[model samples]
Target: SLFRGQDWLQLNLEELQQSTTISGLLLELVATRDIREGEEILLDYGSAWETAWDRHLKAWTKSPGMYTPAHVMDQVASKLRTDEEQKEYPYADNLQTSCFYEYEQDTATADGAASSSKKKKREVTTIPWEMSRTIFDWKNLRPCSILQRSDSHHHQGGHLYTVRIRNRPGLAPNSRIPRGEMHLVSKVPRQAIRFTDKIYTTDQHLPQAFRYPIGIPDDIFPEAW
Candidate 1:
């Protein structure tokens, strides 16, 4: 978890479930607004710790010296990306060349505006979940800029943009190569959107890029989804 005191953005689990990742849990950390090119992304880590403690920590601690294996964590992160799921996530189609979301007019009126006034507003055709996932999963992913605060109460928000080659390929099926970064900028009020459980379950596909070779369990958290 990227903890940034109270100044950090909220981790939207529902949103995270939309993207293809190597973890059973895909955490979508959204920016409150259009962050600048070089702003830092701060998050409230204590909140997540509190939630994990309430839900899983107590049970996790009972096992003597038992901790989540790194390989297991990596496998969970590298799940498959299916075609059916792409129908729900348009941004998944954008992974071929770039994973950035672009707003384009589907239709226009005689006045060179949207045919319907209600449709004139900028529509995010897709959320670049791949970009967000990379930022969170990649070991070598360096933010364009970072800022540190001596005190937690002093809030400092941030943003970033980067174009980099994949350090590890085949992390997920049909994963983007030479992936680029994109931000979910908003001008209107934020939507209360969340990802469903169906969107984040494990896939049957075998591991492709074996960076951390770990044995797959027969019953690998079958109930997690």
Candidate 2:
């Protein structure tokens, strides 16, 4: 269904008149030249379609353990009992254990200071799922310098922080930074201790309109893609 070499057939659109029994439109694939026996039919779908397909092929990547049997995966998954064990396993690369934290703020007194019993209690929980690794190492990450403000109650004071991945050894001098090399600078409060992931049920917590699957069939995909 792609124009591999020179296209052997061309597309033609024919419109029928109102007086005819068949009054709609018909699309015909006419042969461009003489064809040999048992040759595959190829159509030139135009430049736009070809460009889009080329882009998709360039961006596509094979999923982890795509060709492996389900029984083999079940056998491998049964042995992994701990989170550390699962993280080190090669087959469980897609599976990541994310921790969730709950922060409880202490009550403020009439003197405009936090009470003496300002105990910060955190509830830690781990949830594992199939998530692609964005940052290879989280230990090397550090927050940027915070800008000081005279007015402490100001909304914009000391909120924004730029975080970067450290110790990138193989980068050449003066090369443009890759898109995945940097994390998004966000305006988060200094008091906020940790980030957590929330699980949403399909078509319930997540809207049905945004629940469409994204992928293309394997047959038409190019080998060099």
Candidate 3:
């Protein structure tokens, strides 16, 4: 099932402190609504990591090395695994400690080999790339398009990240994802005409489709960008 903006079932992470009876990294699968048999469960991973790529892209345009894919993976790795590379990436561990989980190297599978067999130490930073390639299998995932339309007037809303696509049940047959604000400039020539068979409507369908830019607060994490 696809991740919906508001899912009936949610995956929540909670702290497993000594005062609590929960052990290990607390992972709870909660249902906000009653579920019938054979129904699918869905969860939203939140907007923080969802927009991390866009943040990294903008940051990379300014400071190439610091926001490089490798560096960003290092940042995610620092939280996911160990921050042993703290000497090299002092600011990489931006994720809060409440979300941290130790890397269990022994849990990794070995191809038809004995469990006692020796294996080389795995690099924590590469896990992000591996996850992007393997478990997530992003290439086979749903296809998402980035769309933008020029406004006749100089609207600041066109430059802000206010618009977002909603993936929910019971939408119109011809429904389309909202056009994102022009956060990044198109490399294509301005005179170029790009035609598509798809049709998208703005500020007409869902009330949540077009929100005022000022309604959303600025992202608090400046370092993320």
Candidate 4:
């Protein structure tokens, strides 16, 4: 919004209002980055339009937080490069490296399979009690992820909350992560956010990165995943 060199509107917009830190906003913007499928990631630029130049070399030029966007671009570019320079790679094989949740539904389902028309367009009413034990257990709760918003307005008609399932490195190569990609949990809990609260009753692999403040109970989490 640089019109008269001063008067302007910042393009900075977000789905959340609680983010207050520069790094937090920066990271959110980075998370919106579109990295094309099937790409080997790179993180640097040598000259103005250079390939992934070593950061040690371009440390003097590029801004601090900008590296993420550039790296994502380079990764997409490399992904599209000719096969001569590329090797066989999996198509979104390791999501932990990307943690692209809420981008789409689970791919485990058979492609092109038909679902109920009402179920297709309508919002999923339940979280399959066995699936979301904690969220179901709550006396009153709100969905935390953006997918629900896509189907219906929030209970409060305000913005919705999000939970990012960050990368977990220790799972074996073929480990079967028996959990849905993401789920919604009430942002502000009526009671304190602990194991007794609700979320802890479900799988504990979830990250603590909730838009609303919440804590993990030590009993449920013998060790942080």
| lDDT scores in order | 0.29, 0.31, 0.27, 0.28
What are the per-residue Cα lDDT tens digits for candidate 4 across 1-225? 223312112322342234443332111113347788996676432243342233334543433221122234324532121122223532221111121222123422434323333633333222211123344343322222222221233324433222222223344333322343333222321121111112232222233211222333434321221
lDDT (10s digit) by residue, model 3, range 15-80: 212234323332345577889999987554456544664565564433212212232343443122
| Pairs of residues at least 3 apart in sequence or in different chains that clash in candidate 2 | none
How big is the positional error of residue 76 in model 4, measured in Å on the Cα after superposition? 25
Task: Name the 10 consecutive residues with the lowest summed lDDT in model 4.
Answer: 90-99
Best by TM-score: 2
Q: Kindly list the per-residue Cα lDDT of model 2 for residues 12-110, writing each as its tens digit.
A: 223212233333323335577889999988655556667767776676555433233323443443222232333454333222222111111221112
Model 3, runs deviating above 4 Å: 1-25, 53-225
Runs of candidate 4 exceeding 4 Å displacement: 1-59, 63-148, 156-167, 171-225
In what order do the candidates fall by lDDT, top score first?
2, 1, 4, 3
Candidate 1 segments exceeding 4 Å error: 1-156, 165-167, 178-225
RMSD of each: 22.8, 21.5, 24.2, 23.5
For each candidate in turn, the TM-score is 0.14, 0.19, 0.15, 0.17
Give the distance in Å from residue 16's predicted Cα in candidate 1 to where it truly belongs. 45
